[model samples]
Target: MSRMKIALAGIGKIARDAHVPALMASDAFELVAAVTRHEPPEGARGFRSISEMKAALPDVAAVSICTPPRGRLQLIAEAFDAGLDVMIEKPPAATLSEARQFADMAARAGCVLFVTWHSRAAAAVEPAKEWLRGKEIKRVEVSWKEDIRIWHPGQSWIWEPGLGAFDAGINAFSVLTHILPGALTVEDAELRFPANKDAPIAADIRLAHAHAAPVLAAFDFDQRGPQTWTIDIETDGGRLALSDGASAMSVDGEPVRLDGGPEYHLLYRQFQALLEDRRSDADLRPFELVADCFLLGRRKLVAPFEDF
Candidate 1:
Protein backbone atom coordinates (compact mmCIF):
# COMPACT_ATOMS: atom_id res chain seq x y z
CA MET A 1 0.00 0.00 0.00
CA SER A 2 1.12 3.53 -0.72
CA ARG A 3 2.00 5.90 2.08
CA MET A 4 -0.86 8.18 3.00
CA LYS A 5 -0.29 11.87 2.35
CA ILE A 6 -0.97 13.65 5.64
CA ALA A 7 -1.07 17.24 6.84
CA LEU A 8 -1.01 18.57 10.36
CA ALA A 9 -3.65 21.15 11.23
CA GLY A 10 -1.94 22.46 14.34
CA ILE A 11 1.79 22.39 15.00
CA GLY A 12 1.87 22.94 18.72
CA LYS A 13 3.70 21.14 21.50
CA ILE A 14 2.31 17.64 21.03
CA ALA A 15 2.58 17.96 17.28
CA ARG A 16 6.24 18.88 17.48
CA ASP A 17 7.00 16.47 20.30
CA ALA A 18 5.06 13.47 19.03
CA HIS A 19 3.15 13.63 15.72
CA VAL A 20 5.83 15.17 13.52
CA PRO A 21 8.55 12.87 14.88
CA ALA A 22 6.32 9.83 14.62
CA LEU A 23 5.31 10.60 11.04
CA MET A 24 8.92 11.16 10.10
CA ALA A 25 9.79 7.70 11.37
CA SER A 26 6.77 5.87 9.96
CA ASP A 27 6.64 4.37 6.48
CA ALA A 28 2.85 4.42 6.58
CA PHE A 29 2.55 8.21 6.23
CA GLU A 30 4.04 10.96 4.07
CA LEU A 31 4.16 14.29 5.87
CA VAL A 32 3.08 16.75 3.21
CA ALA A 33 2.24 20.02 4.87
CA ALA A 34 1.50 21.80 8.12
CA VAL A 35 -1.26 24.30 8.77
CA THR A 36 -0.22 26.69 11.47
CA ARG A 37 0.05 30.33 12.32
CA HIS A 38 3.75 29.81 12.91
CA GLU A 39 6.35 28.75 10.38
CA PRO A 40 5.94 25.11 9.42
CA PRO A 41 8.96 22.93 10.04
CA GLU A 42 11.27 21.77 7.24
CA GLY A 43 10.24 18.96 4.84
CA ALA A 44 6.55 19.95 4.81
CA ARG A 45 4.58 22.64 3.07
CA GLY A 46 3.64 25.51 5.36
CA PHE A 47 0.28 27.24 5.37
CA ARG A 48 -1.11 29.82 7.72
CA SER A 49 -4.44 28.04 7.83
CA ILE A 50 -6.20 24.82 6.93
CA SER A 51 -8.20 26.61 4.27
CA GLU A 52 -5.04 27.39 2.38
CA MET A 53 -3.76 23.85 2.73
CA LYS A 54 -7.01 22.36 1.49
CA ALA A 55 -7.04 24.67 -1.49
CA ALA A 56 -3.43 24.00 -2.45
CA LEU A 57 -2.85 20.39 -1.37
CA PRO A 58 -6.14 18.81 -2.25
CA ASP A 59 -4.49 15.43 -2.64
CA VAL A 60 -3.56 15.16 1.02
CA ALA A 61 -5.56 12.12 2.10
CA ALA A 62 -5.53 12.59 5.87
CA VAL A 63 -4.93 15.22 8.55
CA SER A 64 -4.06 15.00 12.21
CA ILE A 65 -5.43 17.87 14.29
CA CYS A 66 -3.29 18.83 17.28
CA THR A 67 -5.04 22.02 18.18
CA PRO A 68 -6.44 22.96 21.55
CA PRO A 69 -9.70 21.23 22.41
CA ARG A 70 -11.81 24.32 21.89
CA GLY A 71 -13.28 25.14 18.42
CA ARG A 72 -12.59 21.72 16.88
CA LEU A 73 -16.05 20.97 15.56
CA GLN A 74 -15.71 23.31 12.62
CA LEU A 75 -12.35 21.84 11.68
CA ILE A 76 -13.67 18.29 11.89
CA ALA A 77 -16.69 19.20 9.79
CA GLU A 78 -14.62 20.81 7.09
CA ALA A 79 -12.10 17.96 6.93
CA PHE A 80 -14.78 15.31 6.61
CA ASP A 81 -16.62 17.38 4.05
CA ALA A 82 -13.43 17.68 2.02
CA GLY A 83 -13.20 13.85 1.95
CA LEU A 84 -10.11 13.70 4.14
CA ASP A 85 -9.75 11.41 7.10
CA VAL A 86 -9.02 12.94 10.54
CA MET A 87 -7.12 11.89 13.63
CA ILE A 88 -7.84 13.92 16.77
CA GLU A 89 -5.94 14.23 20.00
CA LYS A 90 -7.54 13.24 23.26
CA PRO A 91 -10.52 15.12 24.71
CA PRO A 92 -11.71 15.11 21.12
CA ALA A 93 -14.33 17.70 21.87
CA ALA A 94 -15.53 19.80 24.78
CA THR A 95 -18.91 18.15 24.85
CA LEU A 96 -20.28 14.64 24.53
CA SER A 97 -22.78 15.67 21.86
CA GLU A 98 -19.99 16.81 19.60
CA ALA A 99 -18.13 13.54 20.10
CA ARG A 100 -21.19 11.59 19.02
CA GLN A 101 -21.68 13.98 16.17
CA PHE A 102 -18.13 13.63 14.92
CA ALA A 103 -18.29 9.85 15.09
CA ASP A 104 -21.57 9.84 13.21
CA MET A 105 -20.28 12.23 10.58
CA ALA A 106 -17.18 10.14 10.07
CA ALA A 107 -19.26 6.99 9.72
CA ARG A 108 -21.64 8.58 7.24
CA ALA A 109 -18.82 10.06 5.21
CA GLY A 110 -16.91 6.78 5.17
CA CYS A 111 -13.72 8.47 6.28
CA VAL A 112 -11.34 7.24 8.92
CA LEU A 113 -11.81 9.27 12.12
CA PHE A 114 -9.48 8.28 14.90
CA VAL A 115 -9.56 9.73 18.41
CA THR A 116 -6.21 8.99 19.96
CA TRP A 117 -5.79 8.26 23.63
CA HIS A 118 -2.00 8.23 23.80
CA SER A 119 -1.92 6.98 27.36
CA ARG A 120 -3.93 3.94 26.36
CA ALA A 121 -1.32 3.19 23.73
CA ALA A 122 1.47 3.35 26.33
CA ALA A 123 3.78 0.35 26.53
CA ALA A 124 2.50 -1.14 29.75
CA VAL A 125 -1.22 -0.54 29.30
CA GLU A 126 -2.05 -3.61 27.25
CA PRO A 127 0.17 -5.80 29.37
CA ALA A 128 -1.60 -4.55 32.46
CA LYS A 129 -4.92 -5.24 30.80
CA GLU A 130 -3.83 -8.77 30.01
CA TRP A 131 -2.58 -9.27 33.54
CA LEU A 132 -5.85 -8.14 35.06
CA ARG A 133 -8.05 -9.86 32.49
CA GLY A 134 -10.70 -11.22 34.81
CA LYS A 135 -9.34 -10.56 38.24
CA GLU A 136 -11.73 -9.10 40.75
CA ILE A 137 -10.42 -5.66 41.62
CA LYS A 138 -10.56 -4.69 45.27
CA ARG A 139 -9.64 -1.05 44.80
CA VAL A 140 -8.09 1.16 42.12
CA GLU A 141 -6.18 4.43 42.51
CA VAL A 142 -5.00 6.87 39.85
CA SER A 143 -2.60 9.71 40.64
CA TRP A 144 -1.50 12.24 37.96
CA LYS A 145 0.22 15.45 38.98
CA GLU A 146 2.56 17.65 36.96
CA ASP A 147 3.72 21.23 36.83
CA ILE A 148 1.82 23.26 34.28
CA ARG A 149 4.58 25.84 34.08
CA ILE A 150 7.12 23.25 33.05
CA TRP A 151 4.83 21.38 30.66
CA HIS A 152 2.57 24.05 29.17
CA PRO A 153 4.19 27.38 29.95
CA GLY A 154 2.23 30.37 28.58
CA GLN A 155 -0.44 28.22 26.94
CA SER A 156 -3.61 30.08 27.93
CA TRP A 157 -5.85 27.24 26.86
CA ILE A 158 -4.72 25.23 29.86
CA TRP A 159 -6.59 27.67 32.02
CA GLU A 160 -9.52 27.94 29.66
CA PRO A 161 -12.94 26.43 30.10
CA GLY A 162 -12.73 23.33 27.93
CA LEU A 163 -9.71 21.46 29.23
CA GLY A 164 -7.68 21.76 32.43
CA ALA A 165 -7.67 18.87 34.86
CA PHE A 166 -9.65 16.95 32.28
CA ASP A 167 -6.81 17.41 29.85
CA ALA A 168 -4.33 15.42 31.95
CA GLY A 169 -6.89 13.47 33.85
CA ILE A 170 -8.40 12.07 30.67
CA ASN A 171 -5.10 10.34 30.01
CA ALA A 172 -5.55 8.53 33.29
CA PHE A 173 -9.07 7.61 32.24
CA SER A 174 -7.77 6.39 28.90
CA VAL A 175 -5.32 3.99 30.48
CA LEU A 176 -7.91 2.87 32.99
CA THR A 177 -10.53 2.26 30.33
CA HIS A 178 -8.13 0.16 28.30
CA ILE A 179 -6.88 -2.01 31.16
CA LEU A 180 -10.00 -2.69 33.17
CA PRO A 181 -11.91 -5.82 32.22
CA GLY A 182 -15.28 -4.18 32.75
CA ALA A 183 -16.90 -0.78 32.65
CA LEU A 184 -16.86 2.04 35.21
CA THR A 185 -19.19 4.92 35.85
CA VAL A 186 -18.43 8.14 37.62
CA GLU A 187 -19.78 7.92 41.14
CA ASP A 188 -18.81 11.51 41.87
CA ALA A 189 -15.98 14.00 41.53
CA GLU A 190 -14.51 16.97 43.39
CA LEU A 191 -13.07 19.65 41.14
CA ARG A 192 -10.86 22.48 42.41
CA PHE A 193 -11.08 25.51 40.18
CA PRO A 194 -8.72 28.41 40.46
CA ALA A 195 -10.54 31.62 41.28
CA ASN A 196 -8.98 33.42 38.36
CA LYS A 197 -9.19 30.70 35.73
CA ASP A 198 -12.18 29.09 34.09
CA ALA A 199 -10.89 25.53 34.52
CA PRO A 200 -9.96 23.47 37.51
CA ILE A 201 -6.42 23.13 38.85
CA ALA A 202 -7.01 19.93 40.77
CA ALA A 203 -9.48 17.08 40.74
CA ASP A 204 -10.58 14.26 43.00
CA ILE A 205 -12.73 11.80 41.14
CA ARG A 206 -14.58 8.67 42.22
CA LEU A 207 -15.54 5.81 39.99
CA ALA A 208 -17.69 2.72 40.53
CA HIS A 209 -17.38 -0.70 38.92
CA ALA A 210 -19.73 -3.55 39.29
CA HIS A 211 -16.97 -6.00 40.18
CA ALA A 212 -14.63 -3.64 41.96
CA ALA A 213 -14.53 -1.45 45.02
CA PRO A 214 -14.37 2.33 44.82
CA VAL A 215 -11.79 3.78 42.43
CA LEU A 216 -10.12 7.00 43.56
CA ALA A 217 -8.19 9.43 41.38
CA ALA A 218 -6.24 12.62 42.03
CA PHE A 219 -5.34 15.02 39.22
CA ASP A 220 -3.48 18.22 39.90
CA PHE A 221 -1.79 20.78 37.69
CA ASP A 222 0.39 22.16 40.49
CA GLN A 223 3.31 19.96 41.38
CA ARG A 224 6.81 21.10 42.33
CA GLY A 225 8.92 17.98 41.82
CA PRO A 226 9.31 15.02 39.45
CA GLN A 227 5.96 14.26 37.78
CA THR A 228 3.77 11.35 38.76
CA TRP A 229 1.37 9.43 36.52
CA THR A 230 0.39 6.13 38.04
CA ILE A 231 -2.42 3.68 38.58
CA ASP A 232 -2.30 1.28 41.52
CA ILE A 233 -4.79 -1.49 41.95
CA GLU A 234 -5.40 -4.18 44.55
CA THR A 235 -7.27 -7.21 43.31
CA ASP A 236 -8.53 -10.28 45.08
CA GLY A 237 -5.54 -12.31 43.92
CA GLY A 238 -2.57 -9.93 43.85
CA ARG A 239 -1.61 -6.29 43.29
CA LEU A 240 -0.86 -4.41 40.05
CA ALA A 241 0.69 -0.98 39.67
CA LEU A 242 1.44 1.22 36.66
CA SER A 243 3.95 4.03 36.81
CA ASP A 244 5.07 6.78 34.46
CA GLY A 245 1.69 6.97 32.76
CA ALA A 246 1.67 3.29 31.81
CA SER A 247 5.15 3.39 30.39
CA ALA A 248 6.17 0.84 33.09
CA MET A 249 4.33 -1.45 35.41
CA SER A 250 4.92 -3.92 38.24
CA VAL A 251 3.03 -6.92 39.51
CA ASP A 252 3.76 -7.77 43.15
CA GLY A 253 7.10 -5.91 42.98
CA GLU A 254 8.15 -7.65 39.74
CA PRO A 255 9.14 -5.10 37.07
CA VAL A 256 7.49 -5.68 33.69
CA ARG A 257 8.66 -4.12 30.44
CA LEU A 258 6.59 -3.81 27.29
CA ASP A 259 7.54 -4.84 23.79
CA GLY A 260 7.78 -1.28 22.41
CA GLY A 261 8.36 2.37 23.39
CA PRO A 262 6.95 5.91 22.78
CA GLU A 263 3.19 5.60 22.62
CA TYR A 264 2.73 8.08 19.73
CA HIS A 265 4.53 5.68 17.38
CA LEU A 266 2.18 2.88 18.35
CA LEU A 267 -0.75 5.26 17.85
CA TYR A 268 0.28 5.99 14.26
CA ARG A 269 0.59 2.26 13.55
CA GLN A 270 -3.02 1.86 14.59
CA PHE A 271 -3.99 4.86 12.48
CA GLN A 272 -2.37 3.17 9.51
CA ALA A 273 -4.35 0.02 10.18
CA LEU A 274 -7.55 2.02 10.43
CA LEU A 275 -6.96 3.66 7.08
CA GLU A 276 -6.13 0.37 5.43
CA ASP A 277 -9.22 -1.31 6.83
CA ARG A 278 -11.35 1.67 5.74
CA ARG A 279 -12.80 1.99 9.22
CA SER A 280 -12.96 4.53 12.03
CA ASP A 281 -12.25 4.09 15.74
CA ALA A 282 -13.58 6.91 17.91
CA ASP A 283 -14.20 5.35 21.28
CA LEU A 284 -16.03 7.80 23.56
CA ARG A 285 -15.82 6.02 26.89
CA PRO A 286 -12.94 8.07 28.22
CA PHE A 287 -14.22 11.38 26.93
CA GLU A 288 -17.65 10.63 28.28
CA LEU A 289 -16.18 9.96 31.68
CA VAL A 290 -14.50 13.35 31.57
CA ALA A 291 -17.79 14.93 30.68
CA ASP A 292 -19.44 13.06 33.49
CA CYS A 293 -16.76 14.32 35.84
CA PHE A 294 -17.61 17.87 34.88
CA LEU A 295 -21.34 17.44 34.78
CA LEU A 296 -21.85 15.35 37.90
CA GLY A 297 -18.87 16.40 39.97
CA ARG A 298 -18.84 19.02 42.69
CA ARG A 299 -16.87 22.19 42.10
CA LYS A 300 -14.80 24.12 44.67
CA LEU A 301 -12.94 27.36 44.25
CA VAL A 302 -9.30 27.29 45.27
CA ALA A 303 -6.61 29.96 45.44
CA PRO A 304 -5.98 31.43 42.02
CA PHE A 305 -3.01 30.02 40.14
CA GLU A 306 -0.62 32.30 38.25
CA ASP A 307 1.43 30.51 35.61
CA PHE A 308 4.68 31.67 34.16
Candidate 2:
Protein backbone atom coordinates (compact mmCIF):
# COMPACT_ATOMS: atom_id res chain seq x y z
CA MET A 1 0.00 0.00 0.00
CA SER A 2 1.17 3.52 -0.80
CA ARG A 3 1.92 5.91 2.04
CA MET A 4 -0.92 8.12 3.21
CA LYS A 5 -0.14 11.81 2.85
CA ILE A 6 -0.95 13.19 6.28
CA ALA A 7 -0.73 16.58 8.01
CA LEU A 8 0.14 17.21 11.63
CA ALA A 9 -2.32 19.60 13.23
CA GLY A 10 -1.09 21.33 16.37
CA ILE A 11 2.65 21.72 17.02
CA GLY A 12 2.52 21.34 20.78
CA LYS A 13 5.00 19.33 22.84
CA ILE A 14 3.26 15.98 22.29
CA ALA A 15 2.94 16.81 18.63
CA ARG A 16 6.68 17.34 18.39
CA ASP A 17 7.75 14.59 20.75
CA ALA A 18 5.38 11.78 19.79
CA HIS A 19 3.26 12.32 16.70
CA VAL A 20 5.88 13.87 14.42
CA PRO A 21 8.49 11.28 15.27
CA ALA A 22 6.02 8.41 14.95
CA LEU A 23 4.81 9.56 11.57
CA MET A 24 8.35 10.06 10.35
CA ALA A 25 9.30 6.55 11.41
CA SER A 26 6.26 4.80 9.92
CA ASP A 27 6.24 3.70 6.31
CA ALA A 28 2.45 3.98 6.17
CA PHE A 29 2.41 7.79 6.47
CA GLU A 30 4.14 10.55 4.51
CA LEU A 31 4.47 13.82 6.44
CA VAL A 32 3.17 16.30 3.89
CA ALA A 33 2.70 19.45 6.00
CA ALA A 34 2.08 20.72 9.52
CA VAL A 35 -0.56 23.05 10.96
CA THR A 36 0.52 25.16 13.89
CA ARG A 37 0.12 28.59 15.42
CA HIS A 38 3.80 28.80 16.42
CA GLU A 39 7.00 27.83 14.64
CA PRO A 40 6.52 24.61 12.70
CA PRO A 41 8.29 21.41 13.74
CA GLU A 42 11.53 20.14 12.17
CA GLY A 43 10.44 18.74 8.82
CA ALA A 44 7.27 20.51 7.68
CA ARG A 45 6.32 24.12 6.94
CA GLY A 46 3.81 25.73 9.28
CA PHE A 47 0.25 26.80 8.70
CA ARG A 48 -1.60 29.01 11.15
CA SER A 49 -4.43 26.55 11.51
CA ILE A 50 -5.85 23.26 10.26
CA SER A 51 -8.04 25.00 7.69
CA GLU A 52 -5.07 26.80 6.21
CA MET A 53 -3.11 23.57 6.13
CA LYS A 54 -5.96 21.82 4.38
CA ALA A 55 -6.33 24.59 1.80
CA ALA A 56 -2.65 24.62 0.98
CA LEU A 57 -2.15 20.87 1.03
CA PRO A 58 -5.19 19.38 -0.62
CA ASP A 59 -3.18 16.30 -1.36
CA VAL A 60 -3.09 15.44 2.32
CA ALA A 61 -5.47 12.54 2.96
CA ALA A 62 -5.45 12.45 6.75
CA VAL A 63 -4.62 14.66 9.74
CA SER A 64 -3.66 13.91 13.31
CA ILE A 65 -5.27 16.32 15.80
CA CYS A 66 -2.82 16.83 18.68
CA THR A 67 -4.33 19.99 20.13
CA PRO A 68 -5.19 20.31 23.81
CA PRO A 69 -8.47 18.75 24.93
CA ARG A 70 -10.35 22.02 25.31
CA GLY A 71 -12.21 23.14 22.15
CA ARG A 72 -10.93 20.27 19.99
CA LEU A 73 -14.38 19.64 18.54
CA GLN A 74 -14.38 22.27 15.79
CA LEU A 75 -11.02 21.26 14.36
CA ILE A 76 -12.01 17.59 14.25
CA ALA A 77 -15.43 18.33 12.82
CA GLU A 78 -13.86 20.56 10.18
CA ALA A 79 -11.46 17.84 9.16
CA PHE A 80 -14.30 15.34 8.81
CA ASP A 81 -16.31 17.80 6.79
CA ALA A 82 -13.33 18.20 4.50
CA GLY A 83 -13.37 14.44 3.91
CA LEU A 84 -10.04 13.72 5.57
CA ASP A 85 -9.34 10.89 7.97
CA VAL A 86 -8.38 11.94 11.51
CA MET A 87 -6.39 10.60 14.44
CA ILE A 88 -6.97 12.27 17.82
CA GLU A 89 -4.81 12.42 20.90
CA LYS A 90 -6.01 11.07 24.24
CA PRO A 91 -9.04 12.52 26.01
CA PRO A 92 -10.49 13.07 22.57
CA ALA A 93 -13.07 15.62 23.64
CA ALA A 94 -14.22 17.31 26.82
CA THR A 95 -17.36 15.21 27.11
CA LEU A 96 -18.68 11.82 26.11
CA SER A 97 -21.46 13.31 23.99
CA GLU A 98 -19.07 15.45 21.98
CA ALA A 99 -16.77 12.49 21.46
CA ARG A 100 -19.67 10.38 20.25
CA GLN A 101 -20.58 13.14 17.83
CA PHE A 102 -17.09 13.11 16.38
CA ALA A 103 -17.26 9.35 15.94
CA ASP A 104 -20.63 9.69 14.24
CA MET A 105 -19.32 12.39 11.93
CA ALA A 106 -16.38 10.24 10.95
CA ALA A 107 -18.71 7.36 10.21
CA ARG A 108 -20.91 9.59 8.07
CA ALA A 109 -17.91 10.76 6.14
CA GLY A 110 -16.70 7.16 5.72
CA CYS A 111 -13.26 8.17 6.94
CA VAL A 112 -10.87 6.57 9.38
CA LEU A 113 -10.77 8.08 12.87
CA PHE A 114 -8.41 6.82 15.57
CA VAL A 115 -8.64 7.86 19.19
CA THR A 116 -5.32 6.80 20.69
CA TRP A 117 -4.49 5.50 24.15
CA HIS A 118 -0.71 5.47 24.05
CA SER A 119 -0.34 3.73 27.40
CA ARG A 120 -2.32 0.74 26.21
CA ALA A 121 0.23 0.44 23.44
CA ALA A 122 2.99 -0.12 25.99
CA ALA A 123 5.02 -3.32 25.95
CA ALA A 124 3.63 -5.03 29.02
CA VAL A 125 -0.05 -4.12 28.55
CA GLU A 126 -1.10 -6.98 26.28
CA PRO A 127 0.78 -9.50 28.37
CA ALA A 128 -0.91 -8.26 31.51
CA LYS A 129 -4.30 -8.29 29.83
CA GLU A 130 -3.84 -11.82 28.59
CA TRP A 131 -2.64 -12.91 32.00
CA LEU A 132 -5.73 -11.53 33.71
CA ARG A 133 -8.27 -12.62 31.13
CA GLY A 134 -10.58 -14.76 33.25
CA LYS A 135 -9.10 -14.41 36.71
CA GLU A 136 -10.94 -12.95 39.69
CA ILE A 137 -9.52 -9.59 40.73
CA LYS A 138 -9.46 -8.93 44.46
CA ARG A 139 -8.21 -5.35 44.63
CA VAL A 140 -6.20 -2.75 42.74
CA GLU A 141 -4.02 0.20 43.75
CA VAL A 142 -2.67 2.83 41.38
CA SER A 143 -0.03 5.35 42.29
CA TRP A 144 0.32 7.73 39.36
CA LYS A 145 2.35 10.64 40.61
CA GLU A 146 4.44 12.90 38.35
CA ASP A 147 6.07 16.30 38.23
CA ILE A 148 4.10 18.69 36.06
CA ARG A 149 7.06 21.04 35.68
CA ILE A 150 9.21 18.43 34.04
CA TRP A 151 6.49 17.00 31.77
CA HIS A 152 4.29 19.92 30.89
CA PRO A 153 6.60 22.87 31.49
CA GLY A 154 4.47 26.06 31.55
CA GLN A 155 1.54 24.78 29.53
CA SER A 156 -1.46 26.18 31.40
CA TRP A 157 -4.16 24.39 29.46
CA ILE A 158 -3.61 21.34 31.65
CA TRP A 159 -4.71 23.44 34.62
CA GLU A 160 -7.84 24.55 32.84
CA PRO A 161 -11.36 23.13 33.25
CA GLY A 162 -10.94 19.79 31.52
CA LEU A 163 -7.36 18.47 31.66
CA GLY A 164 -4.82 18.77 34.53
CA ALA A 165 -3.78 15.70 36.58
CA PHE A 166 -6.34 13.72 34.63
CA ASP A 167 -4.07 14.49 31.68
CA ALA A 168 -1.60 12.04 33.17
CA GLY A 169 -4.08 10.05 35.23
CA ILE A 170 -6.00 9.23 32.09
CA ASN A 171 -3.02 7.18 30.92
CA ALA A 172 -3.49 4.91 33.92
CA PHE A 173 -7.16 4.59 33.09
CA SER A 174 -6.19 3.76 29.52
CA VAL A 175 -4.18 0.84 30.77
CA LEU A 176 -6.94 -0.09 33.19
CA THR A 177 -9.57 -0.16 30.51
CA HIS A 178 -7.30 -2.26 28.36
CA ILE A 179 -6.07 -4.81 30.88
CA LEU A 180 -9.02 -5.32 33.17
CA PRO A 181 -11.16 -8.43 32.98
CA GLY A 182 -14.39 -6.44 32.97
CA ALA A 183 -15.83 -2.98 32.68
CA LEU A 184 -14.66 -0.44 35.28
CA THR A 185 -16.48 2.58 36.70
CA VAL A 186 -15.68 5.23 39.25
CA GLU A 187 -17.56 4.65 42.50
CA ASP A 188 -16.56 8.06 43.84
CA ALA A 189 -13.66 10.50 43.70
CA GLU A 190 -12.18 13.24 45.87
CA LEU A 191 -10.73 15.88 43.57
CA ARG A 192 -8.31 18.38 45.14
CA PHE A 193 -8.26 21.54 43.14
CA PRO A 194 -5.73 24.29 43.60
CA ALA A 195 -7.28 27.47 44.98
CA ASN A 196 -6.73 29.22 41.64
CA LYS A 197 -7.09 26.70 38.86
CA ASP A 198 -10.27 25.20 37.46
CA ALA A 199 -8.75 21.69 37.37
CA PRO A 200 -7.53 19.37 40.08
CA ILE A 201 -3.93 19.00 41.18
CA ALA A 202 -4.54 15.73 42.96
CA ALA A 203 -7.32 13.17 43.01
CA ASP A 204 -8.15 10.18 45.20
CA ILE A 205 -10.50 8.12 43.13
CA ARG A 206 -12.42 4.97 44.05
CA LEU A 207 -13.25 2.69 41.18
CA ALA A 208 -15.45 -0.41 40.99
CA HIS A 209 -16.46 -2.97 38.45
CA ALA A 210 -19.16 -5.62 38.39
CA HIS A 211 -18.01 -8.93 39.88
CA ALA A 212 -14.47 -7.55 40.13
CA ALA A 213 -12.45 -5.90 42.90
CA PRO A 214 -12.41 -2.36 44.22
CA VAL A 215 -9.75 0.06 42.93
CA LEU A 216 -8.06 2.93 44.76
CA ALA A 217 -6.09 5.42 42.68
CA ALA A 218 -4.21 8.55 43.68
CA PHE A 219 -3.37 10.92 40.88
CA ASP A 220 -0.86 13.50 41.99
CA PHE A 221 0.81 16.26 39.97
CA ASP A 222 3.28 17.54 42.61
CA GLN A 223 5.84 14.77 42.83
CA ARG A 224 9.38 16.15 43.30
CA GLY A 225 11.44 13.03 42.70
CA PRO A 226 11.33 10.07 40.29
CA GLN A 227 7.92 9.85 38.69
CA THR A 228 5.80 6.84 39.63
CA TRP A 229 3.15 5.24 37.44
CA THR A 230 2.60 1.84 38.96
CA ILE A 231 -0.30 -0.54 39.49
CA ASP A 232 -0.37 -3.29 42.12
CA ILE A 233 -3.13 -5.82 41.97
CA GLU A 234 -4.13 -8.78 44.11
CA THR A 235 -6.23 -11.50 42.55
CA ASP A 236 -7.71 -14.77 43.64
CA GLY A 237 -5.01 -16.44 41.64
CA GLY A 238 -1.86 -14.36 42.23
CA ARG A 239 -0.41 -10.86 42.46
CA LEU A 240 0.60 -8.61 39.56
CA ALA A 241 2.57 -5.42 39.35
CA LEU A 242 2.84 -3.03 36.43
CA SER A 243 5.46 -0.36 36.66
CA ASP A 244 7.38 1.96 34.38
CA GLY A 245 4.18 3.10 32.74
CA ALA A 246 3.01 -0.44 31.96
CA SER A 247 6.17 -1.14 30.03
CA ALA A 248 7.16 -3.73 32.63
CA MET A 249 5.23 -6.20 34.72
CA SER A 250 5.70 -8.89 37.36
CA VAL A 251 3.67 -11.81 38.63
CA ASP A 252 3.81 -13.20 42.17
CA GLY A 253 6.84 -11.02 43.00
CA GLU A 254 8.71 -12.51 40.05
CA PRO A 255 9.84 -10.34 37.15
CA VAL A 256 8.08 -10.95 33.85
CA ARG A 257 9.82 -10.45 30.55
CA LEU A 258 8.06 -8.14 28.12
CA ASP A 259 8.99 -6.79 24.73
CA GLY A 260 10.06 -3.46 26.22
CA GLY A 261 9.67 -1.04 23.33
CA PRO A 262 8.44 2.42 22.48
CA GLU A 263 4.66 2.86 22.77
CA TYR A 264 4.32 5.64 20.16
CA HIS A 265 5.55 3.17 17.56
CA LEU A 266 2.68 0.83 18.36
CA LEU A 267 0.18 3.69 18.44
CA TYR A 268 1.09 4.75 14.91
CA ARG A 269 0.91 1.15 13.77
CA GLN A 270 -2.67 0.94 15.07
CA PHE A 271 -3.52 4.18 13.31
CA GLN A 272 -2.15 2.76 10.08
CA ALA A 273 -4.25 -0.35 10.59
CA LEU A 274 -7.37 1.75 11.02
CA LEU A 275 -6.61 3.60 7.79
CA GLU A 276 -5.89 0.48 5.82
CA ASP A 277 -9.01 -1.32 7.03
CA ARG A 278 -11.22 1.77 6.56
CA ARG A 279 -12.41 1.59 10.15
CA SER A 280 -12.59 3.95 13.10
CA ASP A 281 -11.16 2.89 16.48
CA ALA A 282 -12.22 5.39 19.12
CA ASP A 283 -12.63 3.97 22.63
CA LEU A 284 -14.55 6.32 24.93
CA ARG A 285 -14.01 4.19 28.05
CA PRO A 286 -10.99 6.13 29.31
CA PHE A 287 -12.53 9.53 28.61
CA GLU A 288 -15.79 8.45 30.20
CA LEU A 289 -13.89 7.37 33.30
CA VAL A 290 -12.46 10.87 33.64
CA ALA A 291 -15.88 12.38 33.11
CA ASP A 292 -17.17 9.98 35.75
CA CYS A 293 -14.48 11.23 38.14
CA PHE A 294 -15.80 14.76 37.67
CA LEU A 295 -19.47 13.85 37.83
CA LEU A 296 -19.60 11.27 40.62
CA GLY A 297 -16.97 12.90 42.81
CA ARG A 298 -16.86 15.80 45.23
CA ARG A 299 -14.53 18.77 44.90
CA LYS A 300 -12.15 20.25 47.48
CA LEU A 301 -10.04 23.39 47.28
CA VAL A 302 -6.37 23.23 48.23
CA ALA A 303 -3.51 25.73 48.34
CA PRO A 304 -2.70 27.28 45.00
CA PHE A 305 -0.16 25.12 43.16
CA GLU A 306 2.77 27.33 42.20
CA ASP A 307 5.37 25.84 39.90
CA PHE A 308 8.99 26.94 40.23
TM-scores of all models?
0.97, 0.96
The window of 10 residues in a row where model 1 has the poorest summed lDDT is 205-214
**Superposed model 1: Cα runs more than 4 Å off:** none
Candidate 1 C-alpha lDDT tens digits along 111-211: 99999999988888888988998799889999999988888878987777866977898999888888887788898899999999899999999898664
Instruction: Kindly list the per-residue Cα lDDT of model 2 for residues 89-155, writing each as its tens digit.
Output: 8878877888999889998989888999999998889999999988888999999999999999988
TM-score of 1: 0.97
Clashes (candidate 2):
0
C-alpha RMSD (angstroms) for model 2: 1.4
lDDT of the structure predicted as candidate 2 = 0.88
